[model samples]
Target: MAKKVALLQGNEACAHGALYAGCSFFGGYPITPSTEVAEVLSGELPKIGGKFIQMEDEIGAMASVIGASLTGAKALTATSGPGVSLKQELIGYACIAETPCVIINVMRGGPSTGMPTGPGQSDVMQAMWGTHGDHAAIALVPASCQEIFSETVRAFNLAEKYRMPVQVLYDEIVGHMREPVEFPEPGELEVIDRTAPSVGPEAYKPYDTSFGDVPPLAAFGSGYKYHVTGLNKAEDGFPTTKADLVDAEERRQISKVKNPTALADIESNEEYLTEDAEVIIWAYGSTARSSRYAVNELRKEGIKAGLFRPITLWPFPEKRTAELAKQAKAIVVPEMNLGQMILEVERVAMGACKIAGVHRVDGEPINPGQIIAQVKEVL
Candidate 1:
């Protein structure tokens, strides 16, 4: 097969990436900035013998995706910030149920429909904590259309590997921007399928801990009759009120991803000119693009500045940031929201370096000029 190159929008590329990753079902509501994702999948899924459903609301859409995922389909749902807010309960349900699904959140300014058509990174914290409880999350932040495509596939892989919901976080800028992308061939990319049960139907335990931290998931209607609920569950998948069982279940859920070995596999970060730099710009999503340019501009003027962009936002990539803080004099965080990620940077840097935030919440992206100025001030 010839390499396929096309000028694609970020949302469109995300849909394509889902298809390539063997996603067979999409249940989503149409919301600004993210509607293009549903629009593309609606047309594409049927042709590929998959299913596309526009649920009446965001809550229903989230529930439907989890239902489909239970049946062993690589399922997905796309929405903006407000829609994600509405989906929190079901997202939490998916988390506790250990369902594997991909959620694409094209962030718009928000406290409640704050800016439907504008960009904002206000959901950075929400993605990790919006859903109530002690559950782990995997969120991939992509800065470009091409990165969205690749990361969307990676999100599904991670979700299935960990048996939990994974989020692909992009903003209005990257979600709507058009860029040229050459998609890799099927053989060139790695596609992961969920682990299946090894034992007979009668011997199956959906949440079996004896097997491992992440037990094999049995598909619905796969001759396995099992129960799933939002309440803490035992190894057999039944809701448990026992203290020991509840504690064990919660600990397993959190530790599966929190473990250093598992976290290392899911985390991704990009460093630019940071080896000998005295200043570092910590950014992600579209803001990193501006931060990159600012790094180059400062380096040209003999300012030893670099960039540390976290592609994996949820695990937070604290290990890498801590390492950078030990050597750098200062770390400047530029974000679309009012210093959301800066808090995480501060916690990790731990007074090793001065931390400053160049924040914009008026629905405009943080530009290169703003980052350069902040870098100069911090120095």
Candidate 2:
């Protein structure tokens, strides 16, 4: 039998999820709608023999996570809109150094603290392209409390597997709302550890591309002393001024995630009302929750409407959207942002179907009725 517990808020579940994901280090600064995540983790991490630090600001927090990750620890941090902005540069540094770290951004209204406590899905594109330069990124959006936990673990796995930074993008509603969650047994899931080189210290190169661009990582005090920096460098960890070496390093950094088949781990619930009908509705995150209810209601009214949701926000899952678009006559994209995700949807749709973007940025979710109306209009 499944255990039934009281509803758990998304932030609490996120902290618990990080704990379950074997996170031993947390460095963060508190901000609205996301503070609970840092608070819960702070209390629980120490009890489980983990370390938690409340840094002076978000930049220090991000730097601390990268440092902890290089030491071979599964590390994480949680913050909100403005804090996320502060960490972008260090985020790029982590990308260059190939640090395995998880960043949870419980998003509120953005463009610099636009609304501290209000809900918003405005961080979609920023979470994907916020860091400077070209680098591989994976952003997972959780629509409910259950995903808060699952996605946090997924963030860790991806970070470690790719040896890169992964973001679990959360909206204020999902971060603060309460819902039931059942955690699975620990051993049932596969955990990917960082690849450590077995070569002798004298023969090892920390950034050797031959090892699938992932060299065995040596810790700071592991006796195989090496240098790590944000600058372009060679496999031996020395800074290089060569253009070819710079291009090679940048490409290698991106290819690790781009080349991996796990890039498009999309989760969507679609109805085939459109298999015979004319219109499709696309939405995600909190808005998708409401859009789902609306789609069902539309079906009840004999309207042929279906839904498309993206679990993996980054990488955009363009292929799936393209496939769905090819089969439909019209498409509706509802998002909390002012067309941020919708732009991607349109790009992926490839103009195969008639498409329009429905968006809201008034610190509220794009409700169900609005989506149904949009679907009807498109039809």
Query: Considering every candidate listed, which one attains the maximal TM-score?
Result: 1
TM-score for each prediction?
0.99, 0.95
RMSD in angstroms between candidate 2 and the native structure over all alpha carbons = 1.9
lDDT of 2 by residue, 33-123 (tens): 8999889888888898889999999999999999998887899999987888999999999888888999998988879979998888888
Count of backbone clashes for each model?
0, 1
Q: What is the lDDT of residue 304 in candidate 1?
A: 98
> Model-by-model lDDT, in order?
0.93, 0.83
* Candidate 2 backbone collisions, by pair: 197-216
For model 2, what is the C-alpha lDDT against the true structure? 0.83
**lDDT score for residue 181 of model 2:** 85
Q: Judging by lDDT against the true structure, name the best candidate.
A: 1
Looking at model 1, residue 313 earns an lDDT score of: 99
